[model samples]
Target: MSNSSTGEIRIFDVNPALDRAALAEQFSRNRRIQIRDVLTDESARNLHGILARETPWGLAWHAAEDGPHNIRREDLATLSQDERVAIARKLDTAMRGTDYGFTYAQYPMLDAYLKKWSPGSPQDAVLELINDQPFLDLIREVSGIAELVKADAQATLYGPGHFLAQHDDSHVAEGWRLAYVLNLCNTDWRPEWGGYLNFYREDGDIEQGFRPRFNALNLFAVPQRHAVSYVPPFAPPERLAITGWFRDR
Candidate 1:
């Protein structure tokens, strides 16, 4: 529900008792992932505003089954007058620590995006604060298939020309029992753009795609192959989404 009054934002508060149980059951039985269009339109829109004013890099857009706001260091020059000013004033300070965000040299996650350009960045601190809610907490408690290691885990942000190859969440070097993507792109995402998230099952077949819709939460198991695909050449806005992994106790 997009309410134009709150500047095109709507907050869909989960009915704690019911929604949590539903989420737990869905994830336990599906064996893949569940896409929930839980947030209202207005809330999604307002999120776009806060995100635009906060991220370190300029926004680039892409669409696929799943997408993240890709903010590049160089794209800063292309920003509109207002956009540039917003970046300068609002993000200048916040961008400092978020520099390294997170890093892994083995896979060359987005080697093409920063190979020659960014020499060194914040090594590992790409993470965020999870919304304090019962539904999310309950899901963790019952999904006995996983152990909660980090509350707000942030792996890395996907910028233009950058992408993470496919691999199972639980199969990553560190091991992931479960996976969750908390979308923070905070923008209007169209389906055709191409940065959709690709998931795979144990059978080595591609699973479903999670469209980069704002405020949508994509939850699934993480023992098989899964990869994040980059958007096409022309897509303008970047993507912003957070990833979380559960460990086995």
Candidate 2:
């Protein structure tokens, strides 16, 4: 968790002692795996703090044909209460239909960093770390995708009423080789709280589901059927994580 000479925030300290071979074998079994304690204890806590306290979250809603629209925090502040509720109603309708849709809070780390949205913020440093050699090397060794050259990231927080409908990560032209979620949730995350990452069989039965475990990294090959379960109203306030795709391009 050390910073640079100029004191730039460098909170990412991935666990250097992970068993890559075992993780690789696990991933090879089903083309997906969740590695626990992916980061050092101090690093994980520091990242959790950044997401919970420092980052300004925004709304990401994808219910229409054109979306996955991002409403920044400033823009969100401009919407009336009724307008917000209307948007929620649209999401509810979309969710009930047989189509792709998702609603959650997010901070697009790569876009923010590239556009200088929050200069010198920890979120920017996190994006840099994910694309850096150490982290990418770790992912490469475990997923056995030696061509994975870069990654894009976004900080996500799934609270009450949030969900993502089932869809295969099939944007092959985008160079997506694998999708990853670095869960930074509270250690006490309960299964009943919802927000599990669910995988499905061709017949639509759930093949597997992974809880939002703190300090765990869930990696799965792209073009697979998956979805994020809805967070019920009584669930905890935050199910936080850093999520994105590891691309070979």
- The digit string of per-residue lDDT tens for model 1 on 33-114 reads 5445444455444444444443344343223322334555556457689964653343333324332111111111133223
Could you tell me which residue pairs clash in candidate 2?
none
Q: Model 2 over residues 1-249: C-alpha lDDT tens digits?
A: 343111543367778789999999999999999999998887888888999999899999998573879989999999999988888888877877776789999999989999999787888878878887888889999989999999999999999989988999898899999999999997588888899999999999999999998899999999999999999999987799999999988
Query: Candidate 1: which stretches are off by over 4 Å?
Result: 1-18, 38-47, 58-128, 131-136, 141-149, 155-160, 171-175, 185-191, 201-205
Alpha carbon lDDT of each predicted model: 0.48, 0.89
Residue 179, candidate 1: alpha-carbon lDDT: 78
Best candidate, lDDT: 2
CA RMSD per model (angstroms): 12.3, 1.9
- Which sections of candidate 2 miss by over 4 Å? 1-10
